[model samples]
Target: MDLHEPVTPFAVLDADKVATNVARLRGRLAGTGVPLRLHVKTAKSVEVALMAFDGTPGPIAVSTLAEAEAFAAAGFTDIVYAVGIAPDKLTRVADLRERGVDLVVLLDSVAQASAAAKAAVPALIEIDSDGHRAGLAPDDPAVLEIAGILPEVRGVLTHAGRSYYAYTPEEKHRVAADEVAHAVRVAERLRAAGYAAPVVSIGSTPSGHTPVELTGVTEARIGNFVFLDLVMAGLGVCAVEDLALSVVATVIGHQRDKGWILTDGGWMATSQDRSTAQQKIDQGYGLVTDLDGVPYPDLLMSAASQEHGVLSVRPGSAAELPDLPVGARVRILPNHACATAAQHDRYHVIGTGSRTVRAVWPRVRGW
Candidate 1:
């Protein structure tokens, strides 16, 4: 059976769109000369990771040790666990590094640095460029403190989470440039204090697609761009058509009076992340589209239950939509690709212009 008909609630990852998205970003960074590290935390699929690096061992950023191990088993050699290093995971981190995976741990505090130093694990200082999350300030004295304390220091890095909050192209560019400058400043501070050339890195999906001067950056780590979601689209980082990940579901019933279409794809299938609410447009749970991927006019997954989704027409756009009978198939574009993909086990890939499932990439979760 085709991917559209095989199941009522399954993830349909557009293989063609994913490849295109990565290639497009790669092309954008071709002139920069700085390497781009695909953050695997979003997809958590080794196959998608392979596509990011052209099927070879290369630089990647993972959120969990399990993801690092998963990619390491699939032939990925370089992995940076982006989250702060837990005092206990140093052993496993070192074990992965010892096994030929260039695992770089993250340290944000002197305590964390001391612990990693004691365990003989190399780490990067998570720079706080956006002020939205944890990290050492760009010029904070702790930069030198951490560097001096860690036995093996990898470099400096930042996520640029503020980029996601940008409301315009100009705002996005400003945030990206600031993040690059912060990483550069931190790297310079480390160097002045006698540390060798540090690996400077900064990234986010919003910044990845926006115009930014990435002069002093050594690497770019972006993940969500692989599967553009409604939030990304709302922020102008990508168009709705660029969304590669979608949930394919079948209509089971409807609330005729209220113009609601019910589907089996609910909170269990599509994650209930309301990220798009912060943007110009808010897709309830997700945006609804036809079986062929065309968006249904004024439609959204207005609400959801454990195993059910209520699709309804948005206000002020009351044009007659196509019939959605029981068992009729539809696709759902997610608001947050990272959260949505987490609910699925394997991606039923559909290549460009191809009807059959091209590949099934298993997703890794836990720890």
Candidate 2:
């Protein structure tokens, strides 16, 4: 099928770009001796995960039990449910473990640890590396307190969530190093207290790409790297040309006097994520590109309705809006790949520098 055969507002993925992105990270970590526990929370597709792991199942981290269950059914044996485990979800985790899937859970509180311990599930302590979200501090007394409650302490995990704001390579490296140091410090603390806590995992797309010493880290969890978006591009973590995921939309109308080109793709299609707003150059909703994946100069999806995207030249730019007519096709590069991809059920796969659809990969949804 051709890339345009799919109806407007569908997701598209470049298989070659995905492979290159995977290789780039693998190459960066080649000497670090730490394996990548590929995070499926972004792509949420077994095919993408297999591609990240070079067509074989290896260790993976998931944000939901649905992802863990789906991957377990797909022959992924070693898995980590990286989200804070709810006591209610312990039964499902135990069920997966009974099926020979080493499904590890993550938690930061004694309450969660108690549930995990009673469920007999191996767990990782979540450390607050940058205070971007959940997790105990590296030196928090609760680290040992949680370790004392859990029977099987797998290790510690931290994400440099704030690393997304790192604008320069040096800043990204510093954040990545700090992320690793925090996780390793917590792991060392666990080990010193007589727990075998061996897994020291840390990652974010920025940290994963930045070359950092992984002396004591056991694994890195990366997901958004599989589909670099405008956010990553804005952060200097990747180039705009490296973005592999896009929304294929057809022009629905044009407001020539106002210099707005409307498309069938909107917030529902591209998602409501505005992560690039914090960056130096704010991509309102997304960047506009041609169907072949070449970006238009100064064009952006400036506004969107539920099913309509307004494309216009960037404010203050002298560039003219391209003469896109009704029914014309265009591709929209997303602000956040994970959020945009979540709005679609599957990907229309194309090769690098090509428009022909080679395959369609399905994405798993639900909690």
Candidate 3:
């Protein structure tokens, strides 16, 4: 069926673009002395992750155990549940281990570590690369103390989430260096303890694009580079031309009085994530664009309610062009690829036409 015919808003992942992104990242990480452990959290789909790996054995990282189990069953053996695992998840972790999958969990505290140790699987220490959220300081004895736990420690991993907060290329590059530094320091601590510490992973799409001095990192798990978004564009990670995925929305109304083009795509289709973390600039929802992925460069969606998105131009430009008629098809570049992908059940595989040639469903919401 023609993907655009459906009134329902859907996401599309271009097969050709996916392949291109994989190649681009592979070339960037060449000789970095670390394997790319593609984080599935951002991609979410087993199909998308498989495409990202492009016929390579991966130490796949997931945000949920359900994603881990789904990918594991699909023959992905080396999996790391990047999010913290609670006591209740131990049973699922044990089950995955029984299947011969090298399942790893994340822990930040001694109590969490002690709890995870009971699951009989090694746990990777999560380092707060930018201190945006949960993770222990790399030099904190707590990391070493957690690693010292026999058989339960699996070394360390970190996400330069702060890169998401960076407003300039220089700032993003700085955060990338800091990400590598955090990993190096923690890895050094691990060596001092006489542990092999095989997994010193670090990444963030924006930070990964810049030159990362991976001195002691053994793995880099990055996602979102697979589907560049407006936020990435704003941070100067990649230009809008590099964006591989977008939401196809049909213009259902035109408010010339207010200079708005109402599309079927709304907060439900795009997601509620503002992604604007008190930064110098905030992409309210996303950039307005043509069906072919051309950002109206001048147009932006400034406000949105559950099922409605309002479009606008900067104060002075609104009067230049006034109308986007009803029934017109358009695409929206999301601010956050991961959250945007989660709102839909499947990606309508777009190839040479407007029709959906196939459906790629991403694993959603669970352990």
Candidate 4:
């Protein structure tokens, strides 16, 4: 399909690549007896979630209550609201449950547990693992304290976001294994305290693809394996070809004097996330690709304005694009898939390895 025909700055999804990514991740977790509870926080579309779990039975994990409501209304019955719960959100969680949607939540404090007590939604205790994010440590007394406040609490969960920071295969492996250990240990701790902690969950796209032991873990809430970004590829968690998401941008003009290709896709479309800066390779805004998605490793979106993305050649590089005149359409591989997708409201899905538009999937944003 002609990318120029579609309105510029919209997200283009590769459905075939998405299918293969899900399959490849399932292949990695085969024989582990744990289900791939997909984190739909990245894809934010029921259409994409259906494709992500095409033939599998897995609950979708969301990062927001708005996402939970959207997916629930779309016939998704089981959703894991992955983010730590805000006390004020319990009413919304209960409303979803009234609609027969199993909206599981996460908690780390006695205050949240008390807020959830009457709401009665099942909750998972968040574990810090190595992420050092908003979670309690495996042995923190707060675990039992929170559990006691809400007897409906069912499990312990952790996301080793540190995997995104690892610089070596060994380090990534250690992070993944440590995450697994942390979740398992927390579950063991809770069970020993007579809490009946039946669920032990661990995930993070980078660590989920590593050589980690998932023994005794009940759920692997891995996301981003569906549509990997530069951060995942730069961390060696996934190959560049595995990326299923890109931005179809139109070359509005050229800055021949400065050797720059000006595009209509700017920070408004690609987002202002520069997570790759901390990685071994910092793809300025994103790497430029041809209309068909073939990557131009040497070309980068060097800078961006609200409505303009400046594409220029890489430093210390010899690759040249001296003939990409104005009005040319190119796809940009994003740095962070979730943040980039959030900038758009819909996705134009193309055939596997082909650029023709096959379908357009609407997405949800906000909250």
Candidate 5:
């Protein structure tokens, strides 16, 4: 089918670009000996995950239990439910484990540890490396406390959430190093305390791309690298051309007086994630591009309603608005790949530099 055959306001994924991205990261970590526990939260399709691991099921980290269950059904044996485990979710976790899946949960509290212990579920202690989100500090007494409560501690995990804001190369390297250091420290502490904490995991898209030495780290969990977005581009982690995912929307109308080209794709299509707002350049909603995925100079989705996207040239740019009339389709690059992709049910897959739709890959949705 033709790429434009699809109705406007749908997700389009470049298959070749996905392969290039997966290979690029795999190459980077090839010599490190620390395998990538590819996070399935971004591209929830089993096809994409298989592409990441070269057609074989490998270690994966999931943000939701539904993702865990979906991947488990796909024959993934080593899975990590990377979110903090809630006591009520133990039944579901246990069910997955009963299917011969080594599913590990993450937690930082003793109460959660107690519940996991009672359920005989393995768990990793979440370590806070940069104070970006929930996790115990490397030196926190709770690390050992939680380990003591759990029957068998799997290991330690930390995400460099702050690395997204590390715009410079030096800053990214530092954040990545710190992330591994913190996770290694906690794992060593657990081993010293007589707990067989074996796994040491640390990652974030930025950290994964940065040149950090993963000395004692066992694996790195990276999801967004599959579909590089404007946020990662803004952080210097990946170039705009490296982005593999985009929302295809058609031009419905225009406001000539204000130089606004309106599209049917709004915040709902691209997501209301103004993550680049904190960066040096604020991508209002998202960067607008032609169907070929070449971004027009200074063109961006300036404003968005539930179903309307207002496209205009960047404030101080000299580039003129392209002559996109009604019915002309355009692709809008996203700010956050995970959030934007969630707005769509499936991806209209295409090959590199091609306008034909190769396949339609469905996404695994819901909690």
Candidate 6:
């Protein structure tokens, strides 16, 4: 049996396209006077992380300690864990730092800062730009308080998560501007308090991809650009053709009567991230395409269960599955690249049906 025809569903990433995405993102950030701290959560693989930092100096952002450890092991020293670090994980951060790894963690609360200050690990103040998750307000008094108390605090970080809701270029640019304003406010507050808040980090693929005015932001951390998904396409961050990663699954059953194509790869393979569908166009689960990554004219994987994906067909497409056999392989672009990437342990690299066993990027599970 051919290796590419293996039983298990595989996640494939195109090296060539990923390089192009990285180059495009770098070009967009040019003349913005800010360094790009590429996020590693989207591409869990160290190989992909290297590709992200290719030709550029280190300085990458990660979401998990495991990613920090993995990248640190691979000789990447500068890593800012974007997620809020719990009080208990301080030891791990210290350990990585003790080993010469510049592992900068995020602190949102005074208590977290107090705990972090005792650990001797460098840290950043997670300032809220769009309030997608945990972080202090840009002008919140706690920003200065935490900056003062946490002597290890190095800088401030902000994510304009609202860009995910953006539909037009203007909306994305506005979110980017908001992020820059917020980060600048917090950084200035920290500086006024005698803290050397050097790094004013801002992010969001949509906002970063647009013509963002990063006059004050010292760095930007973005991830999804490495593997633009359906969500990025829907938000106009990138075209569908720019999507570099996809889930390759075999068609198991045909719903000729109901017009559904069942696949082994389902919600378990893709994720339950419906953030993209909230836009004008509901992409359902994702855009379903053929083996060559071409979306079928009228077919989309609208719904999915734990182990099965249901395909929604157009009004008159009974002849669409004429050549689709029981075991034909298909590619599925995920709704959210970050969430879907966290669901897999390995990425199966494929090229023209010839498969090469690369490396299984073990994910960091749990909170």
- The Cα local distance difference test for each model comes to 0.87, 0.92, 0.77, 0.87, 0.92, 0.79
Using lDDT as the yardstick, the better of models 4 and 5 is: 5
Q: Give the alpha carbon lDDT tens digit for every residue of 1-367 in model 3.
A: 6665655677877767777788888788885756788888877777777777766557788888888888887889998888877868888898989989989888888877777777677888889877798898877878877776647557788888888778776887799899888877887788788887777888788777887577777888888888877777778777767777778887778778777778778898889877743444566787777765666756777777878877777455644543577777777778888888888877777753345546655555655
TM-score of each: 0.97, 0.98, 0.91, 0.97, 0.99, 0.92
lDDT of 6 by residue, 1-367 (tens): 2335656566776666788898899888876767788888888777777777774437899888888888788788989999888999999999999999988989888898888889966789998888787788887888877877786668988888788888887787788888899889888887887888888888878888888677878888988898898888888888988887878788798888876788888888888888666876677778887776678876777788998987766445573643467787788888888888777877765443344534344554543
Off by over 4 Å in 5: none
Worst 10 residues of 5 by lDDT: 164-173
TM-score comparison, 5 vs 6, better candidate: 5
lDDT digits (tens) for residues 176-236 of candidate 1:
8889898998888888888874688788888877767888789999999888889988888
Worst 10 residues of 2 by lDDT: 164-173
Backbone clashes in each candidate structure, one number apiece?
A: 0, 0, 1, 1, 0, 0
What ranking of all candidate models by TM-score puts the best one first?
Answer: 5, 2, 1, 4, 6, 3
Q: Model 3: what TM-score? A: 0.91
In model 1, the runs with Cα more than 4 Å from the true position are none
Selected candidate, larger lDDT, 4 vs 6:
4
Clashing pairs in 1: none
Q: Which residue segments of model 4 deviate by more than 4 Å?
A: 55-57
Candidate 5 residue-pair clash tally: 0
* Winner by TM-score between candidate 5 and candidate 4: 5
**Alpha-carbon lDDT of model 3:** 0.77
lDDT of 4 at 179: 92
In candidate 6 the C-alpha lDDT for residue 199 amounts to: 86
For lDDT, candidate 1 versus 2, the one ahead is: 2
Q: Single out the weakest 10-residue window by summed lDDT for candidate 4.
A: 49-58
